[model samples]
Target: MRARLTLGFFTITLAAVALVSVAVLPGLQSRLIDAKLADLAELARQYAPELRKAVGTSLPQSELQDLVGRTADLTGSRVSVLLVVTSDGEITVEAGTDSATERDITLDFSVAIEAATSGRVSRGTEAGPNGQVGEVAVPFLFRNPESGRRRVGRVAVFSSPLRDVEASVAVVRDRTLVAGSAASLLALLAGFLVARRLTRRLEAVQAGAGRVAGGDFSARFPVDREDEIGELARTLDNMRRQLAELDSARKRFIATASHELRTPIFSLGGFLELLADEELDPQTRQEFLRHVRAQVDRLSRLAVDLLDLSKLEAGSLELRPESTDVAELARRVAHEFHPALAAHDSHLEVRVPEDVVEVDCDPERVAQVMRILIDNAITHTPSGTDMVVSASRRGDAVRFGVGDFGPGIRRAMLPHIFEPFITSDDAQGSGLGLAIAHELAERMAGELLVESQPGRTTFTLQLPARPTPPRPAAPPVVTEA
Candidate 1:
């Protein structure tokens, strides 16, 4: 990974540098050539007037050559004076300062010819004897004193070689290569280091996950970074904590369930062995049989609770919803608990509103949750403790609650009260009723809320209210007009 990432960065940087060179080098060369031409054209313009006056006077060829040489020295270019022969229409170079053979150079005298013909300055580039050359020509006009008429007699051409411009472009090309190479190297190093660090962090997370997968829940992911990786680490760490808690709960549940199941089976076995004694009296056999029946009942309830809990956990528990009066449902569920209330020597008061508290919910599931809450209250509280089942409507919701006037639940157990196999005290039942109730409430889009304090504990099921539909309007009577 590190090698690949480094190479990727280096390749991108190299390509960028190559692209910049490709785009900029040609323009740079063109501009340099243009600047050189402009300088040559300006020099030709400044020296043309002097050469024209000298020509009108018919100055000696040697002195004209000297003057041209001096101008060339100052401008760092070749200066020449060319005359147009009217009879043959031929151009002849009268004097020059450069050493190039005039015939070879004058073969392409387009700039000078254009200047002489147009009577204006012209500039262009052409191939010279030595190399490419830039030329600027200014027309030389001679004024006749007698008629006061001006005529173009000669053209002054300023020429310069393009080697300097080529040299500058070469230097820039070399420097760009050097800088691009250095940048590519730096990118490679940076990419390698970054990729290495990233992979190391990922590996640490992988190791932690592996440990968790192997059932070592104590391993933790690192969360010290302040980037995306850090956020991932934090999320994984939170998940690990949850899984660890669940694992602990699972172990406790297995141990408790095993013990609960074993006791009933053992009691039934002992009762059967006792009933097998031939000498045992009829009353003793009947008592043993009763004990066996009670154990059997305990076993049956645990089996049913376990099945419900498994279904809830698997998300296969379906609900059948309908618009039902919650007040009446609460009364019915409370009345069903009368047998247990009598056994516990406790009375349950039903406090429901006179008006219907209608809500959209599964009546059977709602009754089941109420039964769980009521049974939980009776089982946990002491004998003779009174209980209350209440139902009412508030705003857009209807609430059915079961509460008890007994010692309240412990503060520490409130958070896990709805967890499977969780009991507040050493109660003689599978502790899955609250878990099933909680799941049922959630499936019905309702909530099971609890509030407990000394001598008061309530578990309330709150479901959204179903509004009553409006009656149809009466048909309008139509009489013949």
Candidate 2:
């Protein structure tokens, strides 16, 4: 991955440089040639008059060559004066600096001819001895007595080689290549460093996840960075912490469940062995049989509780929602516990409003939660301790509460009271009831809360209240015929 990233960076840099070079190099050369041509044209215009006067008179060839050479030195170019022969309609080079070189030069005089014919300055390029040459021509004008107008008499041609512009462009091209290579190298180094750092952080997170998957929750994710990687690290670390807690809870649950199951199975085994004694008295055999039956019942209830809790945690338990009058539901559930209440020597008072407390909920699940709360209160409280089962509507929620006037729960135990297999004072019931109830409440989009003190302990289930739909108006009664 690191190598791929570095190559990616180098590839992008090279692509950019290639694009810029293709776009700029040609234009740069063309612009430089144009600038050189313009400068030659301006210089020709400045020296045209002097060259025309010299050509108009009968000056010696050496004197004319000297004058041309002086102008060439001043302008940093080759200077030539061409005579326009109107009679023959032709142009001939009258004088020039570097006579021998100019005679054999390859420069085409098209610009000088065009300037003489048009009576204006002209500029162009052509093949020369060394390389491409830019030339500019300025026409010399004189009054024509016969035509009553000015006419070109002579032309001054100025030219310069384009080798300097080519050299400059070549230098720029070479520099661009060097700079692009340097930039590409830097990009590769930077990419490798960044990818290395990123890979290390990701590997650490992967290692931590692997440890957690292997049931070793001691490994922790790193969170030292302040980038996206850091945020990822922090999130993974938080997951690690949560997984660790869940693992600890899972181990504790397995231990408690095994112990709870073993006790009843051992008791049932001993009782069954005792009952098998044929010489035993009838009363003793009956007592053993009773003990076996009780243990069987306990085991059955425990299995059911475990199943319900597992289904709730696995999100497999479906809820059937309907509009229910919790006030009526409360009375029904409390009435079912009459036998238990009587057995415990306790009275369960139902406090429900005359008005219906309507809610959209699964009535069976809500009833199950109520049973758990009421049973918990009865089994934990002292004998003859009174309890209250109440249902009421508060704003947009309906609450069902069960309170017992008995010794309250320990403060330290309240936090984990809703956890699986939690019991207060080693009570004689499977401790999965409150955990199942809490899970059910949450599944129904509600909350289960507990408040306990010395005199009273209350468990409240708060569920969202569904507003009752209004009834339709009745049609008017039919009139008598």
Candidate 3:
């Protein structure tokens, strides 16, 4: 990844440099040639009259040649001037002395050919040894009063070697190449650093995940930076902790369930073995059968508890909800418990407000929860324990309570009371009632909470209240045989 990133940076940087060089290099060469051509044009204008005088008077050619040589050798200029004479389809060429060897001598003459053939001023560039030369050709003419104006027997072409302009362009090209190389190297370094920084955190997360996959949930990553990577590390750590806790809970549940299930099965086996005794009396046999029945009942309760627990854990429990009156529901549970309360010699009270406490919940599930709490209060406490069934509204929720004045649960057991297989001295009933009630309350979108102190223990099921609506009338049914 780092290598890929560095390559990407280098490619982009070099591409930009190449593009700029493509655009600037040609324009630089063209502009230099244009400026040089402008200089040559002015020079041709300045010397045109002198050369014309020397030509028309038929003076020595050395005089014109010397002037051209001096102009070509000027301190900072590398210009070469040529004088041509064309007549009867024949041509003669002469160059300035000092600039002869500086540029290529074989320059194309298409523009100069047109000028000599048609007597027109021409300008263009041509290749030379030192580089490209910018050239201009102007016709030479003279006037005689007797014959008016007529073309002279000569043409002068102004030329420059262009060595200095070529040198300047070379310097620019070299600098661009150096800058581009340096920038590409620097970009590669920067890209590697960036890729390393980003991938380091990801690597840590990967390692942590591997450890978790290997059944080690204690692995953690640093979360110092307030970045996305840091947040990811924190999230992974939280998941590990939750998983560790779940694993511990799972182990404890397995051990407890095994012990609870094994005890009753053993007892039932022992009693069934004894029932096959031929020497046993009718009363003793009946008593042994009763003990076996009790063990069977215990096993049945355990099976039911395990089934309910599995359903809750797998999230398969379904609830049928209605806008039901929880106050009336509490009253019904209290009335149903009257017989059991009487059997246990316990006192029961049902209290609710005159107004309906309507809540959207599965009424059977809520009733089941209330019954469990009432039964616990009746059986787990001493006889004559006053168990109160009450319902009232608070905020947008309704609270249904079954509380009793009894010795409170031990603080150590209070926290785990809602866990399965926890009962008072493993007596009165299987320890799954409260846990089942809690899960049922949850399935109905309610919360089951217990608060206890000496002489007072309250289990409250809080459910969301719904505004009371008139109950729908049942449709009439027609009977036909």
Candidate 4:
């Protein structure tokens, strides 16, 4: 916008200059021509009386020419004098000694002579053999004493006006053009400096925004100036600090709630175990025992989820990476969940290649992911449903999946499925199971993905594969330190 405004200013200034120059040029040229004509007319008026006295009483033609020559030399002009009757006219040339060679030329002087005789001055520009010249004619009148009538002779003057007018206008035009050009250049330099300053602030804002988007709540902008941009930067910095404080408060709340819940739950389970052994009817003991077990399970799940969230947030979850057979890992987790599957009337099916599909991952964390997936499938699916656990090599990675035929997760809930405490009506396990599994998988340099439709759901875990050297067995321990 600034650049455009500057350009507009320059355009208007230049146009105004051009218009004024154009408007004044023709008038100035005319005035210059008229002034030269007036000077020549005045010189003619002064010389006319002297010339008439020199050509007194019908003087010889040679003597009249000599007087004309003397007048031309004194005035530095090419002069001409004419006398005419009703039927004929005579002309004599008075050439200047210092001027260029004189050329005899024909001109229509009848109009000029008529104007001079009518007591009016006549002046005009006319083309000559050499170039354009300014011409002026004035009448020389004397009284006839006996008849008391007027006798008249005409003196005409011509001079070049083009060179003088051109020289004067050229100077003005050149000055105007130079000033306009310099102004334009200054405007461009100013625009560049302003653009650079504005872009610098904008770039800093852009970088701060990028950091904020990347989850850096502590990211801030520099406050170096007191302009609007500086105010904006300070506001952003304050917002970042506030966000960091809020985030810290939220994490602290979660940690405190998880820790406080653990103690009472452990006590309740311990007292319930003692009560189970006391003298009581079988039915009451069994009911109390079942409730205690449920409470224990709930507390265990909450504790696990809180721990996993804390580890993920703090960036302190250590991964013991190793290359292991991913297919075997999936099968092993399925086997471990066999009892739970059976209890739910669900059947576990393992699908894997006979050859090992190796991957680089934390074996324990990968197995934990498989356990979470299989358990989730068993808990969500209807009784007697088949839970399939499968693993395969997919390009540079190995993929392990646990799928179930059940009333799958709704589309709206899919986005938040891995969030802690998120659950559907069909979900029986702690919601943190999936969340913990996802965090652990990522720590092991792998990923966990979920896909579900109306009647099917699959959780897939993928990890990179590379050959790893076998670990050497530890040497037998010696008694010596």
Per-model TM values vs. the true structure: 0.87, 0.84, 0.68, 0.48
Per-residue lDDT of model 4, residues 165-239, tens digit only: 567767867887788678667756766677667777878887997898788876779988999999999888888
Candidate 1: count of backbone clashes, pairs at least 3 residues apart or interchain: 0
Q: Which numbered prediction scores highest in lDDT against the true structure?
A: 2
Q: Rank the candidates by TM-score, best first.
A: 1, 2, 3, 4
Local accuracy of candidate 1 as per-residue lDDT tens digits, 1-481: 7778788988999999999799999899999999999988888777767776776566877787788778877778877777754547655444443323456455365787788778789889888766778999888877768889876678778888898998899999999999999999999899889889988898899899899999999999988788998998899899999999989989998998998899999989988888889999988888898899999999999999998888888989888888898867887888888889999999888877666557888899899999999999999999999888888776778888888999999999999999888889997668899999999888878899999999999999988887765334343222110
Show the colliding residue pairs in model 3: 104-129
Candidate scoring better on lDDT of 2 and 4:
2
lDDT of 2 by residue, 1-481 (tens): 7788788888999998898799999999999999999888778778866887887678988898888888888899987677666657565444433422644565667888888888789999888778888889888888888998998877778888899998999999999999999998998899889888878888888888888889888888778879898898788889888988898899999999999999999998888887778899998888888888899999999999999999999999999999899978998899889999899998888887776668999999999999999989988998989898888877788999999999999999999999998998877988999999999999999999999999999999999997765444343221110
CA lDDT of every candidate: 0.83, 0.86, 0.76, 0.69
TM-score of 4: 0.48
Task: Order the candidates by lDDT, highest first.
Answer: 2, 1, 3, 4
lDDT of candidate model 3 versus the reference: 0.76
Error of 1 at 277 (Å): 1.2
lDDT of 4 at 224: 87
Over the stretch 118-236, how does candidate 3's per-residue lDDT look in tens digits?
Answer: 77777887786556777777666656578786754456667767888889999999999999889989988988898788777788889999998898878887786999889998888
lDDT of 1: 0.83
The TM-score obtained by model 1 is 0.87
RMSD of each candidate relative to the true structure: 7.2, 6.5, 7.7, 16.6
* Shift in Å, residue 252, candidate 3: 1.8
Question: Which candidate, 1 or 4, has the higher lDDT?
Answer: 1
